[model samples]
Target: MVATVNEFDQTATNPGQRGPAEHQRREQILRAAGEHFRHYGYRKTTVADLAKAIGLSPAYIYKFFVSKQAIGEAVCALCLGERTGALRKIVEETASPVESIRKIYKSLALSGARLFFEDRKMHDIVTASFEERWGNLEAYNHDLIGIIRRVLIRGRELGEFERKTSLEEACRAIQHTMQSFFHPILLEQNLDHLEEDATAVANLVLRSLAP
Candidate 1:
């Protein structure tokens, strides 16, 4: 079974490499639990409620996850994984470097608001995921950076951008400069006009690399 976006329970293994059956089963748990968590808050969303939503026993849920904490982290991973997929697609197929990179940068900054602020249940999941490990955040960050690097290098190849710095330097600089827009806490504090803020920062960075 392919790893569906529904994955809710996991062992912290590479999500891309999880077994199909595991993915399918865990995805069930994730969807139901995620709903419960969002509706009732983490503390209030019990394993029984999660299991009942999916028509499974609480013990069955434990077969796939260690505890409610693991389920919460997996939910966070599921959400982040979606963003990673979106960025990956942008890097792979975008024909216009400037336009696509600007979108990607803006999206990166607005991710927290879209994923967490609008639906705070995801934020609670993230807080839990951060406790024991970065959960999917680390992998998502690594993959996104690689994708951005690819886009930057592609721009240089197409003469859309000047090679002012090494690809490594350029990539890191872009991420670093956009931190104010993308970082969860920072963006959360300045929620209004977030899209505009991110877009402005994105365009500024692109201009800095213009030929």
Candidate 2:
């Protein structure tokens, strides 16, 4: 019996019943906390604020997450996870490696840029994470680079791309060229032409890798 996300009431899934239900409630709390953080900013939003949004008490929030910073890390992970997870689907589902590459870069650039643009407060969480050095930003970058490298390997396997250098070297080049599209601060400066800029850079990337 799979429980739908809508049905997991945190109150019902208490501490004593430790199982999938509890896990679902934790996800709900993270999402609620994310929304709160988006609106109120990290420094301004407290666990009590998240508790209210999740329809639970601050004490209950502790049952799932140790501290507010923990919740922030969870939220960050969820956001990056969703983006990275989609890369595989884009690569496998698309017939053309070039098209897949284009889609991946454009989706990542636009979505990430739009997210921070819409929720300006969320950027503050990123800043806080860097200042504290408690976050796994480096790991996130490495994972993303791995995904791109796999996609490139697939393209090579299909004879759609010609790699002049090693996979590591190519991945580094792509990421370096597209760094502005990935970084929040760098992206914000060129927001007025992000899609066009992303498409242009993506095309250049493909040409650089052409056989």
Candidate 3:
């Protein structure tokens, strides 16, 4: 399910009879939790550590997030929001379907390269959480496939891509290639020139899908 911005805003607000002060406090605590989780892996990070990091009691942290896993999931959701928003914007703005796909792959590679080189710990945490929460990960993959499928459908209608190619097959192929290129291990191994590798993968996929 796509999380709306309104949901994020509502989550920042208090559900009880508390005023703005409580809402602000909750937002601060969530922000602090995100930082702590990014620094320490979800399994190793404790509520007490998060509370201490934010100068709050452990009990207070529990009031905000029922458990560390919940907090980790929230953080992952927020990160996914940011990444998806950027990708969607790129897809919407690009005039060519192939260019849109190329830009999306390039953006992921650039972002992954940064995480791999500058923040290996956070990268590991995100990878672990994504693998552990395979249901959400699979949903995200399908969402990406849907986006590509829409683009392919449009391209076929416009006679830009071959009408003989099945949109579903093309979407699946693109999604598979994207996942293979975006895998953390591949990014880490090709850290020195990930953009180059991403571009090559993009070109190959575009060639296959082109009329």
Q: Whose TM-score is greatest here?
A: 1
Q: Residue 152 deviation, candidate 2, in Å?
A: 0.8
lDDT of 2 by residue, 1-211 (tens): 1222332233332222223443778778878988888888888888888888878997776766556786787676667667777776787788888898899889878767866777678766764654575454665677778878887898898888996678898998888887777676677777888889899999999998897
- lDDT measured at residue 135 in model 3 versus the true structure, 0 to 100: 29
| Cα lDDT, model 1, residue 89 | 80
TM-score of each: 0.77, 0.76, 0.76
Better model by lDDT: candidate 1 vs candidate 3: 1
Among these predictions, the greatest lDDT belongs to 2
Off by over 4 Å in 1: 1-12, 15-23, 109-111, 127-133
Better of 1 and 3 by TM-score: 1
Candidate 2 lDDT trough over 10 residues, lowest sum: 10-19
Candidate 2 TM-score versus the reference? 0.76
Residue 86 in model 3: shift from native, Å? 1.4
lDDT of 2 at 101: 84
Residue 17 CA displacement from its true place in model 2, Å = 19
